[model samples]
Target: MAPTNLELVTLGHRIRHERVARGWTLDELGAQVGVAGSQLSLIENGKREPKLSLVQAIAHATGLEVTDLLAAEPPNRRAALEIELERAQASPVFRSLGIPPVKVTKGMPDETIESILGLHRELDRREREAIATPEEARRANTELRLRMRERDNYLPEIEKLAEKQLAAAGHVSGALTHRTVSIMAERLGFELLYVNDLPRSARSVTDLENGRIYLPPASIPGGHGLRSMALQAMAHRLLGHQRPTSYADFLQQRLEINYFAACCLIPETNGVAFLQQAKKDRNLAVEDFRDAFGVTHEAAAMRMTNLMTQHLGIRLHFLRVDGSGAISRVYENDDLPLPMDVTGAVDGQIACRKWSARAAFSEQNRTTEHYQYTDTPAGTFWCATQTGTTADGEFSISVGVPFDDARWFRGRETTKRAVSSCPDEACCRRAPSELTSRWEGKAWPSARVHMQMFTPLPRGNFPGVDDSEVYAFLERHA
Candidate 1:
């Protein structure tokens, strides 16, 4: 095994050849694979060896088996940097980043982790530099923190929006029905090839000559939408030319498509109907809405949020908290002037205390636990328990709405209770055994809090919609 110089040289040549075939430039390849262009060049020329991980990356990127790469026929040796550049070009990272392909030799160091950290830091620094004022910087920091905290839930919406856009552009079809697109592709005699998730770089590519389509894998459990998207790429290949000039353009086109699709699927009037049902039926939970509308819980919540704001004129603040006391996502109607930095823990605390005090006071006063409090910045408020699902698990949503002096309650104290105390601490305040422990002591027990107000609109606002029509729609749909 130690006597094979030819095997090593052959590997380098194979790597270089694959890189060139992929249409990548050496520098671009180097950046993608976390190596200097010069370093990749050296590897390609057989002057230096790349690490095993790099070889694996090259194999994956070039669609070559690892054993085959290590066993290719040796070619005449080139300059070291040239070989390295060639090797780097044939890597998944390079392909994802749109870098040129490069050939790499065995034994190079793995720099991907360092490179990722460096990139993240650079982005953070750039964001900081873009700020014009301390207040702006603080606000950005708070938003960033909130995003990080709510990433699991918030990011899914981003993905959904992206999918919607792709579908709208005819770049994807049958997103609403997963298997429909795939069956169509099979009928067209196209083989489905899956690539890694590329974030903003996620793309679908078609080879004009060979009719090969490459597409990013679905980020969620369902593959139907992704399959449809892949079939669309195949259609593009068959149609020929008119390639998108830039990734941004592609994304924009897709987003527009999705917006139109959403409008079509969930019309403004339909949204109004959902809101009317919520208004009339006190027993209507998030699940009931999902069942009624044939949508996911998040979708239902988002729809309700939008309708309550845009149509019914409701200013609503909504948040989701899991049983573990972690706040998930928050959506507020524009009219509700809540502070942007409100933490999930704080909202959870408000919810738990309110519920606990209500139960306790109900027993003492010999009355129902439901009551209104007027101490907070939001003024007189009605509180209720709503339920929803989270990435981690199920959750109870505690909703609070201000009824009077909304301006005073906008940023002032809401009630006499502290936002962090556990009402049952003596008996039940142990560390949560789940993943929400990090957010446990913050302020709220729930994962999220969304609060908003509902506004009554004129009869003609939703042209064909009246209160009875809205109720009838819900009855049929729900």
Candidate 2:
């Protein structure tokens, strides 16, 4: 692997600081390290990476160990400033400004460099804060993800409630039918109404006063999302959820409702029995689960996370990735080391291009599930991904497990395999060093900022809900 630009810069700064402290010129250091004065100058300016042997020789001449010379922290404040400036100058934002970077010579004042860094810092802050999403929402997401991970994704209370409701609705075996869902709604003292305009943001609206559940009119018989949405809306009432007090409360309520819906869609009693049979036959598959329950692949994969570890002694990860490789959802109990932002939120992050979720998109056959065993830095993971489309765009839903758990699942013998050294710059995010060197300054491409980057959570009683629009929608239809 090639050295990252920041590493090279730090090494250069350390070497220069050590040489300067020893009261030696570039020529004097070059004589001891068997390198030319111009080459030493290049090394000090963070433009060139020195060979290991030459670095060792420099350490020997400086009366220090190679490790000391290669420490991540710089020697002094001056060296730190130089390193920061060098890194800042190399950033895409700085490059996009079309301003030539200022050289940090000994004659240049530190105040000037600080001023430039301040400007860079402000520009970076503005770019990051472009989206008006609240930090509390992201923190809530991180907290919920961690909480779910801790429990192995199972909620016994919600599961029990769903089972009880299903039993009351006379749903014993097979998939929970549309009739059962309607029955559950009726039992909850609510009626389901199909409407043309159910608010652009709201998936389904529950009117507590009117005892009604309003849903969109695009659903078919025994559909995937429509039933789930209805059950989720009913969950709020059955669970006696009040208005969310904070973002955390809102997120928690949303998760609970979704969990309740999942349990109702794939009842624990039937879903586990089916999974146990499949495990006995060594034929566990997400598609089979989805087919059995009449749910979407993404739904089946996510539902697995809730049941697999607690019931089947299997730990797994789930991912939903869009066509552009952005991760829209994730859940991992197998230490998948997913990419995350500083807030520990995965929403703003992109899945590794080499991941099975991304690789499955390139498969010529989109009709069936794609399987692969990926060798990531965490460990070997066996994954199966199914690609599908929606009004938004194309997406891939994936369920993966650790190598040892592959025995109980289908596609364990897939010849398709990959090795990914992700969280590394050279893995997939950065261009090849050769290509960067060839096209660094010659190319000027306008970046197409992602739509998700600027779209903040909608404001209302629930996130992504519009109160006035829902009221107006109801006023016209009622």
Candidate 3:
């Protein structure tokens, strides 16, 4: 006789089947359900019984009703076949062909069917490795680049058409979000795929297969903008020329557009206004900027850095310091005379000394520490520090402003304390032979650079900081 818990095993198998039908592997299913794949395997293989909660979790992850999952037996042969057919129809072959298999069956020759089957087998063999290896995907991205280039030549015509249509409609006042752009694309009989929050500067790409457009958000100014523009150019190619038959075919059209829309809508010149507002507000940090402008932290930082460098003529250096006093510096500033080269600096030697003095003074006087430290020649300096932890270990981010004494402000410090000893002591002292002679100068061109310091804080919580406050502060100061 079968085990008494045969029903449970059957249910687990059914759940697994449904997940696989959706093109999800067991590990992916387990992750969605907050369980280990090994545990899920045990449950499916009848070695262990899943809890009630696990059953619900599986159902949720698979998008199946609990009742459907707990049914007495596997789906009927017809139902099973239907599921397989759906999966096959959703395959890349069908997508590239720009038609449904049922439709393809009516017109396709036997040779086409065989070729498609061969392609499917090849894709299956490559699927796991393709996903695992970014280098492979990047190499494959060459095709996308070629496709994007082809589309770019025809962008002006597409943009003209879109602009004309929008102008004729006389509707351009409301904010342009991803949903709005998608609706517009749809009105033009184009499908839409949004990537990375659909930044305002996102450019549209045309899908020749489904006659749709894709829009991905632009996060930075220069390279990001160009990429978005390329995407828009690609969209133009799709809308203006190519035709797509199926949804997957549409996705296959490799159009590249970066942040062209953002540049058009939010010009870099406006950055000064944003920065001025941020400076006054004291509350305007990365997250608030992200939410308000719908951008990422890295993007916002780059934008702010650009504005500071370009308009204000301020030099900004970003430093990553490990607990063991290893420092990596990235400098950005067009106007400043400081070398923008990225190099390792002695961690805790300069910045930490300033911090130690500030911390000691703060503790002794029972007063918050805020002062200027101008020892180097590039100019007076302003600095702020924040502590963060990544998979590698704890780090301190020190952002310095060149030639500005008042740039540093006292914010809430981080709760996590740094380790007592520096981790990179040997390397820190191991000055390169080339630099040994140069290091002797009291105020060499490079040594004259000044940097301010801000104490480290937790990653997300930058103590007593808020977006509104930052905006207000910048506005008041401006």
Better of 2 and 3 by TM-score: 2
Q: In order, what is each prediction's RMSD in angstroms?
A: 19.6, 20.4, 22.9
| TM-score for each of the candidates | 0.33, 0.71, 0.31
For residues 3-31, write the lDDT of model 1, one tens digit per residue. 24444556666777778878877777777
Give the top-scoring candidate (TM-score).
Answer: 2
Residue-wise C-alpha lDDT for candidate 3, range 1-478, written one tens digit per residue:
3444556556656776787689987788889889888888887655687777988988887777888887876665533333344345667755776874653332546565556556666665444222323233333343443343343222344334444444443435322344444454566666555455332322333345556444454434333443334335444453453433322233344331222343322334344566557666643343444344554334444344434544444456544556544444333332222211123222233334333222233333322222233333344455444454567665554445543423422332323222212123332335566777777665447453323334332111112234344444334433
Q: What is the C-alpha lDDT of each candidate?
A: 0.45, 0.87, 0.45
Q: Provide the global lDDT of candidate 3 against the true structure.
A: 0.45
Best candidate, lDDT? 2
Candidate 3: deviation at residue 414, Å? 14
